[model samples]
Target: MVSVQNRRIVFSFLLLIIVVFSSYKADSECDFKAIYNFGDSNSDTGGFWAAFPAQSGPWGMTYFKKPVGRASDGRLIIDFLAESLGMPFLSPYLQSIGSDFRQGANFATLASTVLLPNTSLFVTGVSPFSLAIQLNQMKHFKVKADELNRAGGLHILPPSNVFGKSLYTFYIGQNDFTSNLASTGVDRVKQYLPQVIGQIAGTIKEIHGIGGRTFLVLNLAPVGCYPAILTGYTHNVSDLDQFGCLISVNKAVKYYNALLKKTLSETRTELKNTTIIYLDTHKVLLDLFQHPKSYGMKHGTKACCGYGGRPYNFDQKLFCGNTKVIGNSTVTAKACRDPHNYVSWDGIHATEAANHRISMAILDGSISDPPFTLNNLCRS
Candidate 1:
């Protein structure tokens, strides 16, 4: 014999409990449902390989045990990030067959530049899928995913609401500097950096307009310290820095980073509600090269999978896992016995060990601007 008020209280309590439990979705700890990634080879899982020729050899030997279209011998930073967030590995948007876009998709490609290349992909070896084109692809993906979900054919596609709740990440524009650094020199490359940064800013805004609220932007790595650049560009005695890195090129890299940080700052102001983070890839890599002991690395600047001997071990004509006919014999650029000891994987990209280090730095909030940790990206 409970009173009327007590009966109402019991009903209200039961109703509230039902509502709370009904909303439980087992979301990520960070509250991010999915991740939409855009970048160049640094994060390219299989875009270029699917769209064009696939890379062979020991590209993914270390971890994946086979060539998975990634330029690295194992996982990239993006892979580690997905693991950290408890999400499935992202598939390439261009990869049509056997792809699962239920978690997210990668739009990055090898040799991809933010700006459209002046020449064809074959001529310059730069990717045709620039940032703008990637954005358009994302727009189309959103609509198609929703349609598939409505049709009950979206088992492989993410829910329509995921596009807005997903984290938008960018690791591009490295080629924008690298491609021009050799031909155009630092001055000319510096002049066009604004355009590169603008393109990235606009891309973020576009994602935001489509309901994206979280973003993680990675700045350029230290190209001057890369074995590829060191081998490609011959520097005089005075041009080398204390660590034997190119002084002039590193100066230009610093300049580009400064401008990039400023642009991200402005973009953050414009998109007040969005969570924009700038991860310092440059600083993290430079420290790894300069202080290898700190990262348990031995061969700081040398490439683990390239031709040439000793100090850098990178050849301009011979890339890692490439084969060429020479003197009636075929020579392949093979990997080292101990890739974990080296920093550079193919003189251009980082080894999986190095990629892990970079991811840890960001997760620990050491190299990220505004100091956001992995567990909470949306926090101020």
Candidate 2:
């Protein structure tokens, strides 16, 4: 009994409703306004030097004019992640100058671990800014942000929005393995992994308790493949894996990663409405090592800045820089002409080029776990 005009009007209304719902869904998926990072040197923008202030030149030659507290030559994975999100590079919480905490803060520090400072495994000695301390700092930052929002009359997010909508990233645990392996053996490290993962889980629960709903947890990379670890230890031919990496250490890394993934899965279940993503950085790094040409890397095993040594072109005493003391002799770590072709900047961290590739993969979901990519999580 309806007129033709009424039928057309109803069809147009239905179409408009569909378009509006779709737009709403898309907006909800990609509305991350801030990022908060917690970990060690791998993600530290400047927290270490803010506390120490002893680091010097040839460190930030690739990007910044001088050492900016980043352990690498240039930008890190955290930097690249922020760039992808169209957010400013996060300022280290300890940094006092030119800081724009409107996006969020970097609570990571060099040599930080999931364990408490009193633990025997913290090789760098007892640091005041442990992960627990960093968590506490985040709490303080939230309160300060709230105060600023109220006073300045700026349109910054409220405390609830800041934590709830922000992306929380953790790139830790390598130091724990390294310290433990050096102090205690591999078997002991393996046995202690449960406690380590438990601590990580506990930290996540604490953050969730404080309104953090989204998390991106990067698992341990191939620590055995690091030039520092490679040159530091004396290993038999059997100890080396096919990739010329330490076999036992890599095996331990795999075990730790597996346990970490399982733990995150459980944490995700326990925390309702939470998004916990376990990024497979190991797989990405291993792929780059196996097929360096694919990523435009010419030297996968060698460090870009070091005394060019055999097998891995890395010298333990002569780190990445113009000068270092090698067995009482002041030796210079000659920087490579083309760092872009190399995967590692120093003997430990990835070069900016490598970090960029890894970050792109993470954003595009190539290296992320299923059902959650950095892009999707930010949008969601």
Candidate 3:
């Protein structure tokens, strides 16, 4: 015995309820509340300096106004990614003071390789914190978190909830290639790439074994495009790529990326109900170098902070923000006036500005393999 007006009102109310519920479900699906990262200096927050503690001024002048152990002048790819997810910057696992694990942790360190100790042929002094060690540290963190959750007084989410729901990101393999290239010539390195990638794949599988359902794996950037590589390596004029980068070195990167993609595809099939997004960082970086004006970059081929002349402006003897005695004269490595206009921060790492642009593309899923962007992967 309801009036016609009452019937219409009830229908509208039901429609609103359905819409609200759908929106909530969508938000929950995309709500990646935590993030765990692993890699080298490309993604290291502070793990390297936590152990060595030698970083100083102008290293973080762009954003932090002081040295913060980041290899770059400001933030890193992992930092921007965390910010995009509305999470605070991840604390380096080794950092003791003011560290917050509620969001997640960064286990990356400078110059970390995938190969185990005594296995890397190119790298000289091996650190104890390799990818395997980082994974072990992650396991320890999970155990501690689980204990706290069981205690019921101070809980940082159950380890199961953290690993199962959080996003696990990796930006490794560049150092692996660099180390191998330095020790064993290019041909030998190429021969060993498959084994190296297999080890990387095995590590990913280990993470998968642990409740890790989501992965954001970034492939190697164009290593030849790095000013340090260009300055150090001898390249034939005919072998230079369109961007004047070392063609042979870049070819190796392409080969590695292809193998990595294939390995990830096989992994996807093996690990059911998992989301894996392979980010094409090489292409993105090449595009940036090719069209520097488009990204507001003026010095795409040079280090923003170094003591050297043009073309690369990078020095092997003087690292970024370092002062060295050249012929008994103190020559200091100075930072660029406008770091935002430069792509390479210190001949190796990307500037915060560059990382921001790359991160935006990643968030929108523009440069990801299979077109499943970070947003889509998290929400799906």
Candidate 4:
């Protein structure tokens, strides 16, 4: 009934349709357009300097030329996550110094607390932008969108924008309890943690309502294990090596992380477009602490800066860059060699390499169940 030439033409068209369909299906399935981050120094790019200089110094010596305001040697959890996703490193929301937000921005500060009246006072701490404040910023972004539309400018995301096309990430609350312990004691954790955890859940719901569906929530790492706290307090050697964790602080971290996991599970059940995935940073970090050789980390309990004496310095005078005055005598913190290889437990925070590893793990889905790795997040 058909000629040979007509038969060939039909077959060619069928092949073309198959190719086009495959391409389109792939694109539609994995289309992530934006990444919004909120949290503290662990993920902060440069939020510290917005309100204070001391919050962003000495530690930022390796990757950055001087200090770009990060509390670490260079980079943080956010930077690693962006890099893993093949996205640009996000600029700090407070970094008016030099960055283009046409890409993304970090709202994390040094001392940000997740709770209202967040009872802590370390100079240049987390801003009042609590989780609620960060969501307000998103609302403010929408206001900017309206203004732009009125001015004949295109909106970053129009109302018709598809859900699950962006990823919302949070790495907050370490300062809430850490500062509490540093200031008063861990006993107060039981009293205030419930309120803080509730706020976290509320914040996630708000983001989901505001059009965020693909979400990643980083759980608290071992708070008792930070080099700053580790060096500050005298520890039982047996307890330290057995877990490489501080019992008192870690106990609080467990309670908070457990509550956080439950909160995320509830959010997943309630929201349609939203999926709250966890990054067990606490467990992974402890594993890393116990097995430093696997990640090429040599230092665990000591920081790259700060006084190297036993039960390391905590007073402001003996800080990483501060000059100490012992009977009018001055002393400065020490620096380490090859910071790229060292996992900072001190000089205020962890090293860039450490963040990169965590980011890679998170992107690979090793941090969550039914994992959604970085490649998976950006396939389309």
Candidate 5:
């Protein structure tokens, strides 16, 4: 239990640290030279696909017109954000070919968790590129980039000064909760939240130590509302909320975000000249789910891809773009013709249209704590 004084400090910091945004592009004089991203598939440009040559297909069809590494049908929140900032899409740190890291590098990968998994990727399908590992990779990137720049490879990597001028974005932690939900249960998941939150905080501090002054830490989305979760969990009708999402799982996500926010608040006081903005991902995502029509989405909760029909369109085994022999017939989980109409792309991630809406909320300051946008970061 925190002391009353410590709790007060946390609350004050939240108000002080999180602030406003007027517009996405018009007020875009916020001159961030580059962006270094750390997260799961939510922001992964191509790390996982580059690492593992999976047999899956038909991703990135909406925008990229090919499998360009994102789990969604097209660009993610990170892509929209980069475009808003007038920066090109960040190249994945793991992708070796045709990737230009002069602007930034994306260290995020699919199925990545905050904590390092005990099992290997082959055994559990969880990414080995955990938060700590991403941190190490960032550290190494700085060292190597500096070396390359000194060795006349200026065009290959950004200048050393760009590190301090970059925006460090984190869209991780969702996978951490989702992967453990079925295995450990919500109560057990709650018990480990502090460690998870601590890892997130510690990563921020480490980035600050390495000259990262600006950060965008995102809270977990409503895990209960995810089609994958809804399909996987054993919840009766009474366990669901009005939107047909599991109340218990969302409650756990709230608890996790609360802890995350408290820790981020404290992080602000510890770092000097640092600006940390914790995105209220739960609120934004829940709001998006509640009013899909408001965002011009047709299916609020159903996934646009996957095997299972209706409700969620998610199957644990038969994933999106996957073709397998299911007892009698060879079934393929293909994407819907109108991917833009969906809130969920694969029952796990948001569609490109939904990603744009989320980015809009972030940049427009509706979900910001102090009602400020990236433009305010320039003032801070």
Candidate 6:
């Protein structure tokens, strides 16, 4: 027979084991669950270039080991976010060439924008699908996932089962101000910003309506600093960094975010199931610009892949990688020693590594205030 002390020891051991097992199970279930993405090139993994002819070179040489349609060499913001959540990278909607949605999906297109009416960024035959269209695609995905689940096929965890497990990330609004409104003027930014904010809020609400309970909305990065825009225009050198990243543009972004916060607050009050968390990419970008060394970046003022120098920019030939190079013009564009080591990708977009840092920051509960943080919106 066991002694009384031995019996107590056994009971304590059993209780400890139970507690450990419970904690393990909770964490295991939190593995990157479901990822739904909507936005433009910054987060697009290649939806636009899927059908277009291959001419651009710097398109996808870094990550996929070749041009895979994503604007970056490897992944995008959404990809890293998915990874952080312990989920496989979501497939681009156009990558239907041979995709299995059981994992996750992406509806972001290279040139898509948040503008309500939607406008073209360039005349390169890039279709600027609005955010609304992307939302519709997500709805279709939801329907398809349900069908697959009912048919006994592999499927994403249901929105119900995946409620807190799922995360939707948005990286939009830059093109609206840069491609559509900026060329027009800041007045246009001030004029249409309210409508822009409303549409974004409506998009989030729509997602919630369709069982999307958690969202991570990344505000637009500083547009004024894009190498493409900054290098070409003739402006005061003193105000260049602050140019494309105009006070007006940043102001508009702040206003939009403020409205979004209010809208989300009201939304959560009415819809207990839905929650929206705002991530501040704007400040991150600014920090990167002001302090490149801290982020291990070398060139914050110029693109690593474009062609141009001093007082003028001319990357019209698409020279980042090599579908357009004829017999090798010595590869005029420059790539950093290590892309993973750098913060900015190309000259305008954040590299996969940089995005990963930001995503981690969000998870670590670093930025948690209005116009920058969204801790209140995301609750396990």
Clashes of each: 0, 3, 0, 7, 6, 10
Model 6 ranges with Cα > 4 A deviation = 1-12, 15-28, 53-57, 116-128, 154-165, 241-259, 310-319, 322-334, 340-343, 369-380
- CA shift at 348, candidate 3, in angstroms? 1.0
Model 3 error, position 44 (Å): 0.5
Tens-place lDDT digits, model 4, residues 1-380: 99999999999999999999999876655456557788877777776676566553566777775777777777787877676556677876666566655545567776677875444433344466666676677667656655665677553333324333667888888877776565556776657787777887788788777677878888888767667666555566764646466787788788888888887787788887567887897777776666777877766655666675644333444666656667766777755666665566353566777777777777677778436676664641
**Residue pair clashes in candidate 3:** none
Please report how far candidate 6 places residue 289 from its true position, in Å.
0.8
TM-score of 6: 0.80
Residue 323 in model 3: lDDT: 89
Quick one: ranking by TM-score, best first? 3, 1, 5, 2, 4, 6
Tens digit per residue, CA lDDT, model 6, 1-380: 99999999999999999999999776665544667788888888767777464646555666676777777767776776665555666778777566655546778887676765424332232355679888888877777666766777564334335534567778777666666443555566667666666778888888787767777777767666666555433355555334233455455566766776676566667767555666766777677655667877654555555555532222645445533553655556656546665555666677666666666667665653333332332322
| Residue 193 displacement in candidate 4 (angstroms) | 1.2
Identify the superior model by TM-score, candidate 3 or candidate 4: 3
lDDT tens string, model 1, 352-373? Answer: 9999989988888888887888
Candidate 5 Cα outliers beyond 4 Å, as residue runs = 1-29, 119-123, 375-380
Candidate 4 overall lDDT versus native = 0.69
**Candidate 4: residue 140 lDDT (0-100):** 79
Q: Global lDDT of each model?
A: 0.86, 0.81, 0.82, 0.69, 0.86, 0.64
Worst 10 residues of 5 by lDDT: 18-27
lDDT at position 74, candidate 5: 90
Q: Which should have the higher lDDT, number 3 or number 4?
A: 3
Worst 10 residues of 3 by lDDT: 153-162
**Candidate 2, RMSD to the unseen true structure:** 4.2
Across 1-380, the per-residue lDDT of candidate 5 in tens digits comes to 99999999999877665543335434556668889999999999999989996735578899988888898889999998888777789999999888989889999999898988874312287899999999999999999998888888757689989999999999999877878688778997788778889999999999999899989988899979888999988888999988888999999999998888889888988887888888896787887787888878888779999997988899998889988999899999989999988889999999998888888888777776535586454422
Return the clash pairs for model 2, or none: 29-379, 29-380, 30-379
Global lDDT of model 3: 0.82
Minimum summed lDDT over a 10-residue window in model 6 is located at 371-380
Clashing residue pairs in candidate 5, if any? 19-372, 20-371, 20-372, 20-373, 21-372, 21-373
